[model samples]
Target: MNPIEARHWISAEDKDLKTVSFFHLSFPEQRAAFEELIQHTPAIQVYDTIWQQLQELMKTRHPAEKLSPDLLQQKAAAHIGNGPADEYGVWVYYPWSQRLVHILDEAEFVEMRTSRNQHKITAAEIKTLAAKKIGIIGLSVGQSAALTLAIERLCGEIRIADFDTLDLSNLNRIRAGIHNIGLPKTTIVAREIAEIDPFLKVTCFEKGITEDNIEDFLQEGGRLDVLAEECDSMDIKILSRQRARAMGIPVVMETSDRGMMDIERFDQEPQRPLLHGKVPDDLSYTTIRQFSGEQRMQVALNILDYDNISEKLRSSIHEIGKTITTWPQLASAVALGGAMVAHVCREICLEHNIPSGRYYVDPDQLFKL
Candidate 1:
């Protein structure tokens, strides 16, 4: 808008992107005026050396009108690490980070524009999905789920949580690759969603879900719109399914068994029992914690064991560990898994009641499912 601001823009005769500009308020500009306002405090000093040097940092004037400090302070109280604050007594935090605020607005813009394109999803049945929020616990398969839902425009919102980083080994199946190695999965996936649909609503929990923080991750507006169990922890699987059942959101999963679609619906209907309403009647999430070891076995059994039932040592491997250490490749053989889940999501989103179960295939004959 201003002459100096104009310098931040980049243009090309041939590119299709909408251009945006970045500016760090000059010392003589608004930032300096703001510094004169706040009485110099110890905490304010620490922000200079660290946050000031970070790429895309901002020093703003007055209170952030869009993001209330009361709200973010409450969020930080719940989310900040238990370590010590910096020299200035001010700790780096989110909801205040310029990048994060930009992402929330961007995700919403992308989602709204994409959703309004009724030409793509001509079905009215999808309206219900608009308010649906999915909690994705891990980022590998969860990344696939997020991309799937975003591309298809299946849901109204998404909530992502992961406590790990992008490891070099993850490049094989993760949406990210070598360049992203070591970044937190939630951060990486948040960026991916923003890139795909800037208007997508993503609330990222940088921490992994545990008994301690699960409620914080839920955000209180509603039970998850749905739950996708992507984490490999057998214990977490039991907890997620139990929580979903108690809250009344259906759960969907896409597994790679040489390209099989495993769709497990945990009741969205009222007064339903947990596990497709086929289990205990008085279920609280805690009530179902007893299901850990056995549920893992039953679930593994449901997924066809590639090597047939495991013999002695192999039994221990699958019973206590992994069989397919490496996920399947993304060739036609593997993509079949995504397609099957897509079919299942269409059914669930469109009000079709598919019997709850796992679907699969043998490596030699993919797509048979």
Candidate 2:
């Protein structure tokens, strides 16, 4: 490394650790020394932001006590690295951030992380959702719902399934970037959730849900609190509902059309039919997979009430595989679906009175003549 480059690299490390140092030297002399340091102390240097924050928090917690900041820092230091911190408060480099960060220990992290959610979730409700596991199928539109749930801290864990990879076409609806091209949809969703809150457990089904794995996906290890079904495969959608119903797990689905969303409280009403009995309960998976062009269009019509969908979207459905590659979708509609489904998920998990039915968030309808 050149003298300037080596010094720049060494200085970053030195900033975090007081003992680490580098001698100013010529390019040639610095090369050997820099290489040695790189070989030996390879750990990434991270800022002590969490430590600083915790100290500040202590001051706020005891405003009238007037405790010494140094004393509080000393007390907090012992508890800092014990939980979520990287092996006891050790700093690590995060690729996404491209910077070093102190992974706050889990408890402190939770306290600070969900502090903003206080009046909204309440301490009791937050605890309820934190212990629940949510299963999400298909990461394209489901990406929005999963992200919304994560941001709200609505569930303790999330399981996602998607066999498809990120394609440029998905950008119109799926929240992703060109850098995510060709990556598995599940991977992108998982990374997004982890970046938001590393403590939340995330499980991925890269191959997508299948008959063989469907059972385990729903209740093999731990049953899901709610199932958010959003996938292109007609068969998987039906099959997932059957499994969720059998396991007494409530189901929620968002259709990126007319801002429509469906909620099925199968847990509360076990006999409740899938999609409000829009299609036959006994519809075989094989039959759906082999659905002809016209048959698929009819199914779409039945699922999304023909009368309620905008005329433009209704006409666009007929052009699938001809003028259009697939059903038309907009980022606005997809994002709205995500937020709506997230709200329903929280409601169902908390045993709120979210009835089983189809609801529309159509802005056009609301402002109609």
Candidate 3:
């Protein structure tokens, strides 16, 4: 038995390569490593990282006894923390893995997203063209979108930019776990993407995005095929829209209404309201803000009164950040929505003459475009 057999390690060797390694070790030696290195805290941390993930598989479902001994064995190697949690969802460590796992589900916020078709992307012309350079802003939706794109291995390069780090609250929507806390969203995202597909290039913009640096923001990538607007900042959205249009690149923006996905395409023509672009120069920024406010109010009112949403659901919205409230759903919807929208965006970019337009998907009502 070798040392690593009892544990798993996500390793990055070169500019574009990552792999998970499992080694062999005597069960007794492994137990010692688990006890000495993977403390209860870290062990718990690892467990929490995949708690929900395992639960979804039926193999790792709760009550502990339900899991086969062989399956439980895998848990020790996958621990995300340094020790055991004092409670079900709270933890500080997982010693064996020596990793930090953030808790987001305790808040009942978001879910992890996955793709149905794996090979559908790799066969496209985009893959042969080398990787792409995309700057992702924010870690919430941005993280999910980045992970989906990374796993597809479509783009040759991806640049992640975000000042914030991972927290338990973000688990609802982000792909990162607790160890990434205070790690800077961009850094964690880059690290995760690199770990996922080493062959794909990942760059970081950890300082966050701003209008002053917007041009320099994408300078590293040279010309971009698309600008993904996933950041929650309204100001950044406006600036990105303008920069993308001025440079003649397509931009993809999505708003998830409960389980619904709403995509905005700037690929058509500049005159067609490029987010913050002038509307005939008659609508000033102030006026546009006012109009946007009214529209936001209308949406809220519809959900509250006309839509007949329960007070519990309505109250849940108040707990969310202003940006997320624009769209709400279970983890499944958010994850699927992010992947689906990204799938289409990648398709449109690679297939010249592909129709560029707004599209939506709602699992509940079965809306797909």
lDDT of 2 by residue, 1-369 (tens): 333221111111122211112222224465455445446655644455766767765655565776676788876676454554333432333343334445454566676667778778898998899999999998767999999999998998888888888999889888887998987777777667766666677777778888888887787558999999998777888889888888899999998887888889999999987889998988877788889967866776787779888888989877877899887888888898899989999989898899898888998888889
lDDT of 3 by residue, 133-249 (tens): 655666566677778777765566666667676666667666666776655666666667644443456666656776567787666448666667776555566666667766766
CA lDDT of every candidate: 0.51, 0.75, 0.51
Error of 1 at 160 (Å): 1.4
Worst 10 residues of 2 by lDDT: 4-13
1 against 2, candidate with superior TM-score: 2
Instruction: State the lDDT at 361 in candidate 2.
Output: 91
The count of residue-pair clashes in candidate 3 stands at: 49
> Scored by Cα lDDT, where does model 1 land?
0.51
| lDDT of candidate 1 over 175-217, digit per residue (tens) | 6757778777777766566445544466666667777767655
Q: How displaced is residue 321 in candidate 3, in Å?
A: 9.2
User: By TM-score, how accurate is candidate 2?
Assistant: 0.80
RMSD of each: 15.3, 9.6, 12.6
